[model samples]
Target: MNSLNSPWAAHFIQTGAGNNQSFEQAGALTLENIKTLFAECDKPYSGLPPSALKKAIYSSDLSQVQPLEKVIEQTNRLIAKNSIMVQHPHCIAHLHTPPLISSVMAEFYIAALNQSMDSWDQASSATFLEQFIVDWLVQTFSLGADADGVFTSGGTQSNLMGLLLARDWFANTHSQHNIQQDGLPEYGHKMRIICSDKSHFTVQKSASLMGLGERAVVCVKTNQQGQMDIDELQQTIEALTAQDLLPIAVVATAGTTDHGAIDDLHGIVTLCRQYGLWSHIDGAYGGALMLSEKHKYRLKGIESADSVSVDFHKLFYQTISCGALLVKDKSNFSSLLYHADYLNREGDELPNLVDKSIATTKRFDALKMFMTLKSVGAQTLGEMYDKLIELSAQVADSVKENDHFELCCEPLLSTVLFRLSSHYQGSLSSGEFNQLHQTLRLQLLTSGDAVIAETKVNGKLYLKFTLLNPCLTLSDFDSLFAKIESHAKLLTNKAL
Candidate 1:
């Protein structure tokens, strides 16, 4: 049982548990198997009911290992049947996008080697590559030579990092205590963050995570265009100051979630500077506009921000969980630094990425962008995004022209907010219309004919077309709108 002489025995042990450096295999078998599995995923969705889908996945037992071929087949079935195919042209929901093929190809190597960005010793070249990518991002934001950044899982983590640093900076400069050493300062409840009402909910959620209660978040009013009203923000700040509350930071949205609204960055930044408050821009959805010469101006004050969150997965056409947090001054990252003797000792000169990120064992996702940039330069990506931004305006006009649909506002970015108007006068109330939109959205989702987004604005439910698919045309949206009308009409008839 313990014989080491046999080549087969050695191979089995090496492949199962030994480090790749000590015992590496070609991995050809698994790669070929996965390729075959991917070939089966042709449909946008599985079309299976919730219960049936659960049964398919949960029925498999983990007590014993199955044949590799059978496992591959099962995985193929899952990929083909159960996945939410973001690549589908009709999947204009959320900030999701069809990933660039080059980025997907880069994931193969990223997964194979399994590099971590936490320590320079572990990731080696990956660490430098990530830093290079971060530098490119800093340059893109025009944050100057002093700018620096770190990649994150996504917007949430980046937002958290931004708030965390801001929190620590507040504790250090405003008070005698250091939060990193002595915990949250006294009167922490008095600390507050200000942002537009349309900014992502992550701002409030992040405050809660940092021990600042949700009440610490102050929602400033936005204009009809969904941008943060600068006048209202100034008044709110003055009122907060009169109350003697600590204004820690002001979070600005480069693009609001529902309306794709871009707040006046210059306006917000001016106020932040005036108040001596940290400026953080949540550009998770609209950050990619920086690539476009035409649209980059939308994110004007983003370069002036102390911290910025950009999700490449959203507009860059990259896979999930690829985002970055950039800082105008590289030294501000010291708030996140806590040298680990065993990992990145004080004596070590090499860069330790963990000092700047919430995650330690991070994937080399920057490779996806690097590969994409190398294959088809940044200008091409910008052009693709410009195409969509232009399309969103056209789609909004289509909705306005259609008597059946009530357009929420002029299209700002790639999102068009609208709702189906009920013809029944006095019979259907605002609440009933809300229910109608909710019902229609669910109906369409269940049918899998199309996947769109929905959000409530001014207490009125509205449908959203978060169009990120560059290849999709106004005709595709027209077809989807037609289906919505047909579906809504059928529902209305049944009710009558």
Candidate 2:
């Protein structure tokens, strides 16, 4: 039977007719359910153990169909109730950011429209909107008139695209061979990509996926400040050449995960030019600094990079999974070009976004950034980021002053790495000291007092505070510290 005559007629969104009442009702209901759920949960998390949560989630019978209102209620009870509340002031664990209200509103429009970005016919206006945003990004980074970019899932996918283009470009320029058409060359095993030891793990992961194995990634050690040691980097590159290795590219990190150290971009780019290697700047975290007039100097020479990766979800306050990869030379994207008769025909004059991306059937993610830029404006976003950096510095100083905590180093962006003082450890062995920190973190999480992160630095445990929330103030952190101290004292007393 036709949908109009069937029982499901009310479920579909009807265009050209009056407003879809069902959609309006469902949207209002969902929003109310979410507000109620947030009001009931006071902590960043519900503090439910994995086993209990799993049992509660599976208790519902999925085979049974229910009305939209009932479905929303069940979802809140089972899923949203247990999910991490990233917007909470004390949820300072990862790079995740609380999405901006403007971007959140954009997400609703994005979902309702359901535009697929691969072809123009499926996303006519969306395709052009994405291009306009990309053009603006290219200009913001000073990537030249010939540059272009495409939105990606996040840093991982963007990094992969940079390396893929670098590999193909190197192969074609040097040996007149096309790696995409011919696969890895005979000397593929000798090809090497270089990055600092503090670079994201995605560098090695990309190398493995490219069929060069993990060994193809040559890591240069960092300096005392956690930045890539420029002198050591030069030595490493020279050593690789002496060993007859083919160094095709250098991935310079704009921000390290643990220390938030920004590498010397100009220094790295200079060396890359000297060696005739492709220079890629992985600015997934610190790229937002370009908006800050005060901190933009840290990203000097970024414009000279052959490619760059930026994530809006991190510091830009957009929703999750929104990032872009920009290339200095737009023609380099030819390596990823492919045609399909049904979707992106070769002779078609209309712009198809699939030609610039590794993904097809992509969501209209660019709309989120477009709306955010228009509503919030770039100047306000810059000031917000600057405030986060200032807060990190203040926290670091406070940690140094407290006898109970030991500051690892100064924060360059917004991450502070520190640990409990040795006096608090009471002559415990190295392993036990690390265990103490781990236990305290867990205790805080279980009590739902705070949600902090832990990482190892130089084989010693260090707690990390990734300050991404601009709304948070020093007073908020003071309270969080008091809870941490209480937890630590309880654990230490138990050990005694």
Per-residue error (Å), model 1, residue 124: 0.4
* lDDT on C-alpha atoms for all candidate structures: 0.84, 0.91
Per-residue lDDT, model 1, residue 12, is 40
> Which pairs clash (backbone N, Cα, C closer than 3 Å) in model 1?
46-81
- Reference-based TM-score of each model: 0.92, 0.98
Deviation (Å) of 117 in candidate 2: 0.8
lDDT per residue (tens digit) for residues 1-496 in model 2? 7556667778878675664888889889999998888777778888888688889878888899999889988888778988888988888989999999989999998988999999999999999999999999999999999999999999999999999899899889879888888999988999999999999999999999998899999999997567999999899889999999999999999988888889999999999999989999999999999999889999999999999999999999999889999999999999999878988887889999999899998989999999999999888999998999999999999999998899999999999999999877896888999999999988787777788999998889998899999999999888888888889999988886
By TM-score, the best candidate is 2
Per-residue lDDT tens digits for candidate 1, residues 1-496, read 5454454453343334443332333355556655664566543555676677788778888897875556656675664457777766677778888889998889888986789889998899999999999989998889999999999989999998998888888788887678878889887889999988998889989999999988999999888778998999999999999999988899999888888899989888989899989999999988899999998988888888999999989888888879999998888787777877878787789988999877878999999989999998899999998999899999988998998888889988889998886573136677876887788887777777667789988898889989898998888878888888888888887655
Worst 10 residues of 1 by lDDT: 17-26
| Best of the candidates, lDDT | 2
